[model samples]
Target: MPDKDAGTPRVFLVRHGETEWTISGRYTGRSDIPLTPDGEHQVSSSAGVIVGPGRIIDPSKITHLFISPRTRARRTYELLFDESAQKMIEGKSETTEDIREWEYGAYEGLLTAHIRAARKERGLDKERPWNIWVDGCEEGESADEVSNRLDSIIAKIREIQGPYMHGEKGADVVLIAHGHILRAFAKRWIGFPLSTSLPMMLEPGAVGVLSYEHHKVDEPAFLLGVNMGGSR
Candidate 1:
């Protein structure tokens, strides 16, 4: 199902900037970790890219700016957008359980290297031996589980396109969320199943733009761009 001319929402998805856990390569799932100084600077610098004299972003066109309730995401929204912009999209800027990072559960707080080392000792050496997205969630969700959850969230966004794209002329929507979840969101957006999230490595502090063209019901959504680099 494609979005009707009711509106075409341009979503600028931002993975929350870095944190101490990220720098340390720890699995900070479900943990309330604050941004490191570098993290804060990364997001703050994006503010200049999106706004200001150069003003890459057309402020007047932006409407709904969404964010996870996590401090890291919320802080990014605050820094990237202004107070009034936040107010305009407060309700839409919601904390979605689906938008939350993949629940690492028992693996939380462990580094990839450490996990792999432990796994190697136990003969768990494989690309996705412990990949929660495929196997069962180790004390958490399977990849299918995470995919289904994110599907519902994307559905909600599509359902609210009218108000989300609400603007004097048009609107640009923003979502500040975690890396893994956002990657899953991308997978779902292209009509791929949950397992498709395997290859798309959503990097931290990255900003991706999703654009589409709809002339009628004839053309679905055209994949305008994705995982675009340049501005963090």
Candidate 2:
């Protein structure tokens, strides 16, 4: 394998900016709510910090974009990359349902506390409180189902990034989606089961990087910490 950091391909996971549901702590799956005014500002401000040249996620380094079909995600992409930057990667970008938010089903638009209360009222989770990772949503996707979905995406991403492990260029990929789905994708990226309870969190409008250890494609890993004093 090449040097640990040489030309290693990376996946940048971006959770969409805040929505009313996000602030309210509601499950926002497939509801299609727009970002709040603060959300728009948040994404725009983030772009200025991380999406510029020599910043954390330079637009020029983005080889491909896999964006969720949700309006909030698409709008995040719009505000994230300026018109010039968008034009730069327009041909390589794709809007995909594969990366959409986790389906919440009956739990949609309900807060976690309320979901647990409802489940308790219905005699569910008496063994323990409701846990999305382990118990999943009623009438929605199970942990295994979500794992299967994300595993397929990881396969496609690896295919695109495998060739670049040896310092090849143009292999940085970006995924724009929701909080739970992106966190789930990170777990699946590292071969962890959805019920593993890794305690990972991706804040709205924040960016996280997934890459391989020692420039080896088979050794998938993620940056636990980074110092951004200079060029990314």
Candidate 3:
């Protein structure tokens, strides 16, 4: 476990750009989907605005990057960082399964409406609506399971930032992953349960910041006013 110190170390959560399933609002889990042309362009254009010298994610200060193994996520990672930053991140980055999208299982590739209709037909939750945070997906990961996995990763991140807290001025970590998992990660980062946290909307190519309030690691909080900088 890392020591909770008064330092401004931050974590940047980057959701992958658009994909076929993403555009269609289909549940994409273990399936490896590539980003669409627009997705690539969106991420590519965001690099300068979000990751340059004075940007939210200072490329030079990035200590480590955790990227998802999925194609869309990896591609998004490549597009988000420029060549110089890529070189700096080469040895510090690793592809981890912990950051992959939520496993949709039987609900994979099904749109939200279709899943709801199927659930209604199957006599599941006839009165109430389906919520992934509570109901989760049939034969898939529960919200608690997702929270646990993200907690493990967050612990690792804290461990990595421990030494840098006292020594360096900037020790930033970056995570490039899918929408649901990243949103869940942000909630867990702030020690909030999925059911309790407000619903967060993370568009493709959008970025979110997670850091400590008052520079205390024990006081984790999400940074607000994170503009995507330009049209996506």
Clashes of each: 1, 0, 0
Computed on alpha carbons, the lDDT of every model, listed in order, comes to 0.65, 0.88, 0.83
Give the RMSD in angstroms, all C-alphas superposed, for model 2: 2.0
Show model 1 residue runs off by greater than 4 Å. 1-7, 52-59, 87-91, 120-128, 162-171, 215-232
Stretches of candidate 2 off by over 4 Å are 1-3, 229-232
TM-score of each: 0.77, 0.95, 0.90
Q: For residues 90-157, write the lDDT of model 3, one tens digit per residue.
A: 78898999888998989999988988889888898877878888877779999998888899899988
Clashing pairs in 3: none
Give the distance in Å from residue 164's predicted Cα in candidate 2 to where it truly belongs: 0.7
Which 10 residues in a row give candidate 3 its minimum summed lDDT?
Answer: 223-232
- Superior by TM-score: candidate 1 or candidate 3: 3
Compute the lDDT of residue 218 as modeled in candidate 1: 19
For candidate 3, the lDDT comes to 0.83
Cα RMSD for candidate 1? 5.2
The runs of at least 3 residues in candidate 3 whose Cα sits more than 4 Å from the true structure, single-residue gaps closed, are 1-7, 165-167, 226-232
Residue 9 CA displacement from its true place in model 1, Å? 2.3
